[model samples]
Target: MSEIVYGNLLYPQDDTPDETVLGCIRGARDVGVTTFDTADIYGMFRSENLLGRALAGEPREELVLCTKVGMPTAGGPNGRGLSRKHILESVDGSLRRLRVDHIDVYTAHRYDPETPIEEVMWTFAELVRSGKVLYMGMSEWPVESITEASRLAQELHVPLVCHMPRYSMLWRVPESEVFKTCDDLGIGQITYFTLEQGVLTGKYLPGVDWPAGSRGTDLKGGRGPLMRHWLDADDALTRIQRLAPLAEDSGLSLAQLAVAWVLQHPSVAGAVIGASRPEQLHHNAEASGRPLEADLMSRIDQILGGDLIVHSA
Candidate 1:
């Protein structure tokens, strides 16, 4: 299994030069990363465009390109949602921006409350049959929704290979019910935020002024507020500090330990980590193929506490 996946969520901004993003993408490829994940909403479409540019010369067959839809790409009420019209339109935009004839995995960014499940599934079924998408998936969907969608997918004879969710030592929402539902439905999990927006990197020390060049400092695009829960939770921060030695003893960095911990679950197929610089890929790739022993796993669970919030949202 591919343990770590490169995510375009935090790809270099639209105004920023493309050289950094291109270097990061190629760096991951050079390090043997076969799967790359992105979304239409990422960077408001800039991420896909940059990734398309970055992968221009790579062997198409050797790389697995995964992308998503169902988020607003433009203004107005028609901008987003999983309606057949929106999906049909969005897939083409994604394809053109990605410069790919067919996407290996095309996922629904989220369940659309406004659209019927049947409509969404049927659209995806059409995409698969038309050869534009190899498999279908969802992100951050509840178990009930997944079950309903899976039923429709089975009826339509389309393969729903996996679901993307935020899973890490910091968040275990999937373990509560999503994992079991997917397990029963034969769906895999491709988790994101394995490093908790770099919180698990041990760079954001408690009570320290938001460090220079950190996500917390860049409050633009509304990214900083998302880290408030971790930054404000004094207890979680203390526990994380204590965890540093344990990770060192295991010959793993805290980031690597957090990622490998997520992959320990049978339902998880991959963990997505966003890289802004090329060197970050090397640290993340090392997390793959590393085994964590039962005792260490138990110790980690105890440290995080049994009553950890299942979902961040």
Candidate 2:
């Protein structure tokens, strides 16, 4: 349960070599990264498959293998969603791909409105009881769904331990509602996009074309669309430019500063980041276990401005 968890999004995508992905996973372990997060839909289940190979010969007890279901892995009505049929079927595939007997944490990749929450809860309960999945979590689920699921999970005695949400200085939607809801339910937040798809890494500058081989370059279906709003905003870039010097003064890289900022929230148990290279993993891994000063946090808020933060009910 470290402050930073590794993600496997960039792996298997962009045609990254198997050796490199394996090295990244091993490198993460060398840097003391305990938990790795991925989903079935990511790289069309190839992410988990590669992770399985990378984790070969590693101590399973020491590592937490977290993978998500409910995302479409193939073309079909039953191919996705949190339906009992899908959950039951998908867990086995994830287990097979991860090369594990059981998943440490199995999360719903997204909210499935088609299926009733009761069915989802019961299915998760069965998985936990059967030892196919140790814990249940959700990603990008609405506040209302989380509230209802919390109630049902308590009733079912299912361990809903954490929530995975997209949270960053640029993406404050979680702050508006998801964070508070999860907090009230005693669910820790292991957030993704802590670096805003590498936007906060100080690598993407305003008015300049993306550097070669960057995620912004559609190297593997870049996060361009998801981050378009922030990437295109001149004001956001200016804020990032101003924050860079402050991070340098604090003796932290911009990436480290961004990670630290997200970790400052008490409800955040960890932040998830993707790595294409071992050195990238090593650099971001440094962000964990470091506390930022309150003054610096306030300064960051000032730089981002009040309007940037979305506070929801």
Candidate 3:
């Protein structure tokens, strides 16, 4: 498995042509990236369609294709949840769109309070038994929910292999409980937001306006609102700037340093990275397998002090 998994969340933008998207996916594969992750809710199912078309003729065994379910895909009570019906229907849709016989890792995008843990686990087991999904994963779930599902997975003999979480130097909510719980459960993590939506790249200055096409200025897609926390925190932005010198000392760009920091964790199996341009994939892929010294890690923490960081629940 590749250390860096290419995420298709924001790829194939509104104006980007199908050919361009296909080239980007092939470019990522050529750079040694083997895992590709997308979701049914991403781009309202357009992402999966595009990804399916992009990877049509690739060697299926060499790639790890993952997609998610359990998000509101339609308007009605049965539209979205971990219910057996929804999961069953969603898997077929994903399979059709991805042009795959079976998914490498099928993840639950969010916990479904409306569905019982037993129902969720049994549904996943059915999928695994039928060869529709090889492994199960959960994203952004509470510790209690993950534990309950894990317990049920064990009872059902299902393979609950990964937990997808939003983990980064600036956002450390997983450190408080999720990390230890997943570690104890023997579940690897595939982390997203490792770059904190590009804030950790030191591109957005403390005082200057955001770059023209940056996510900080993308209001229509809801990315700007997600970035407001860091954008509004001048002290955090200033602290991020301080890390630039450290990144230079390590002979890496700020973005590379950010990606490397997340991959340093033992439980992290891979970090999901999104690339709009093909060159961006090559740049970010350099962070894989590069180890940072312990002293450098400590210095990074010192530079971005605890006050500006969220290190716990």
**TM-score per candidate:** 0.95, 0.96, 0.96
How well does candidate 2 match the true structure, expressed as C-alpha RMSD? 1.7
**What local lDDT score does residue 251 receive in model 1, on the 0 to 100 scale?**
94
Backbone Cα, N, C clashes tallied per candidate? 0, 1, 0
Q: What is the lDDT of residue 58 in candidate 2?
A: 85
Give lDDT for model 1.
Answer: 0.85
Lowest-lDDT window of 10 residues in candidate 1?
9-18
Q: Taking the tens digit of each residue's C-alpha lDDT, what string does model 3 give over 192-264?
A: 9888888887899988998988878776563655589899988888989999999999999999999999999
| lDDT, candidate 3, at 275 | 73
> What's model 2's TM-score?
0.96
lDDT of 2 by residue, 1-313 (tens): 6667889885335588778888888888888888999888877888899889888778889889999999777678898899999999999998999999999999998999999999999999999999999999999898899999999999999999999988887677788678777888899999998998898998888888878888777645765576676678777777788899889988889999999889988889989988888999899888787788889888988888877654431
Best by TM-score: 3
Best by lDDT: 3
Give model 3's TM-score versus the native structure.
Answer: 0.96
Clashing pairs in 3: none
lDDT of 1 by residue, 3-108 (tens): 6788877533544457888888889888888889999988888889988999988889888899999888877867898999999999999899999899999999
